[model samples]
Target: MTARYDEIGVGYALGRRTDPRWLEPVVSALGAAASVLDVGSGTGSYEPPARDVVAVEPSAEMIRQRSPEAAPVVRAVAEALPFASGTFDAALAVLTVHHWPDWRAGLTELRRVASRQVVLAYDTALHNDFWFVREYVPEVAALEDSRPSAPEIADFLGASSVRPLPVPWDFTDGVFPAYWRRPEAYLDPAVRRSCSALAQTAPEAVSRGIDRLRADLESGRWQREHAELLELPEWDAGFRLIVA
Candidate 1:
């Protein structure tokens, strides 16, 4: 499992670095914390530039791929964070909870290590409503169905409020479902490789889907169905920031 990230995390810095638009809300949720622990901090995508950040990741390749100036990374998993209790003012898990074999244990570890708060930025079932799932890749939604619900995540963290921050389509951080409005990106091999679902899916199915999408774009079918998206600068695809 750890090896998967090593193989896939090589191009992560160039393809998966955090977008500034989404970073604003995540930083705001940190709430002036002096120090932060970034769990599953692949290639330091969302690590804040100004704050003190300690990143934890199990994949050594990911750690090596991190920005030269990124916070020092500790090779560790979220279920067993290598930090003392209340070691950090805040802890953040971004798009990584679902990847954990034991989600509950990981969340407990995050809550235990953070003195002030735990902020999670992830997707929910609401992502299924996006055009990509509704059109080209319904199987990806099925793959993510196993992820814990937002309410469940909030409850596990003893969260008083579950804030849902709208992630605009212009928010191009390259996580799954971020390219709903830009259907052509899916046809690109490099872009598709960045998605775990597409990367892991049966190659035959992926090839077929890509072929279908190409045909749709060339035949004007995709534009006819989602033409409204072309004129709009942004869209709120169902990404949210849950502050606990």
Candidate 2:
């Protein structure tokens, strides 16, 4: 199935750019690899400067947005990679596995192609932790909770070892949990458009949620309860890098 990346994922590169704080750990998990495979490398967000990276993504729009400096972009799905067996020293699938039709098959493909390591970065659950999910949009949280779990993914990989890395970032990337601390940003249409949940949900539901959020912000109801979050520099919203 073709994802509407062109329509919804258009401003993603500009708004959802990689957080530098997360890069060092993600790249380090790849080990001392010379050649790397960046699976679902949308807009080349986290492609490291050191390695000889090769990117693979299914979305044509996402592939088209790849930087000139990034590795050559290939239009391919994770369930079935186009490269030869053991083609890469390490592989990275960052925040993209949930979109795959067959996550198990995709993990198998990642294992089959990589000689050294396979790093998977994604959030475990968005519903339980953040106030946005617990308060304004529980439906979106329900949608996200259906995604595969970290343990399930690790089992599929037959990982000899699994390490959990923390998710720490400063600014919101227009993604769901990105604005947990900055509730005011969610009121912006541009910010709301960047969220897949808001984009995929029924227009009426999204509009209702937006309207409620707007009312809460205007009445200072959001601040009255979650005013403490403003003091924090970053939050650990159940995001992790699963290194195998």
Candidate 3:
């Protein structure tokens, strides 16, 4: 688990940043909190701005890419946070739980360290709904277990709200699901490198999928099959926010 990020996360921050739309819900979940713990904080993408945030990460490569302005980060993993119990007002783990060696232990650690928790995760129910997952890179979808959802997250952390977060057609965060309307983005090797789905998948499989996607796009078949998506401004692609 520790080695996965260092290997796949070398350039994670280049295209992945906090979408401004995500900040409002995160701040709302924080609810007047002054301090926060950013667990599995990769390149400080969603670590809240202008707040006292202490980040815990295990990968030296990921740590190296962290912005100069990000919160002071500790070289550690989520399962064993170094902070004392109740050390902060809130804790956040955004799109990161799936990578943990022991997710349950990590969630319990979050509960122990903070009074409130804000987590962003994807619902497995809609995993196959993505065109890339359904058609191009089925191997990428095979990597996800049947666990990452709002209710499951709420159950783990005892959260109060587990609601969906929409993905803008031109979503700026560049998370895997954010490219629902912009399928061509997947063609760029640099763009795909930012998402673990592409970075971690079997190279042969990735090559096969990219060829299929490129063929579909060049043939105009991709646009014909998913024409409605172009008009929609934002879409619900199984992304959700859990707040407790």
Using TM-score as the measure, the top candidate is 3
Candidate 3 per-residue lDDT, tens place, 1-244, comes to 4557888886788789778898778777787888999998888878877789999888999899988989999998888999999999999999888787788898889999998888888887686678888898888777765445566777877778887899988788888888889898989988888888778789899899999999999999999999999999999888889887
Model 2 misplacement above 4 A: 126-128, 160-169
**Could you tell me how far off, in angstroms, the CA of residue 63 lies in candidate 1 after the best superposition?**
1.1
User: Is 1 or 3 the stronger prediction by lDDT?
Assistant: 3
Report the C-alpha lDDT of model 2 over 177-241, residue by residue, as the tens digit.
Answer: 77777777777877777777677667777777778888998999988888777777776666667
lDDT of 1 by residue, 196-231 (tens): 767766778778778888999999999998889887
**Clashes by residue pair, model 3:** none
Runs off by more than 4 Å, candidate 1: 1-3
Listed in order, each prediction's TM-score against the native is 0.92, 0.91, 0.95
Number of the predicted model whose lDDT against the real structure is largest:
3
- In candidate 1, position 111 carries an lDDT of 84
User: Could you tell which candidate, 1 or 2, scores higher by lDDT?
Assistant: 1
For each candidate, the alpha-carbon lDDT, in order, equals: 0.77, 0.75, 0.85
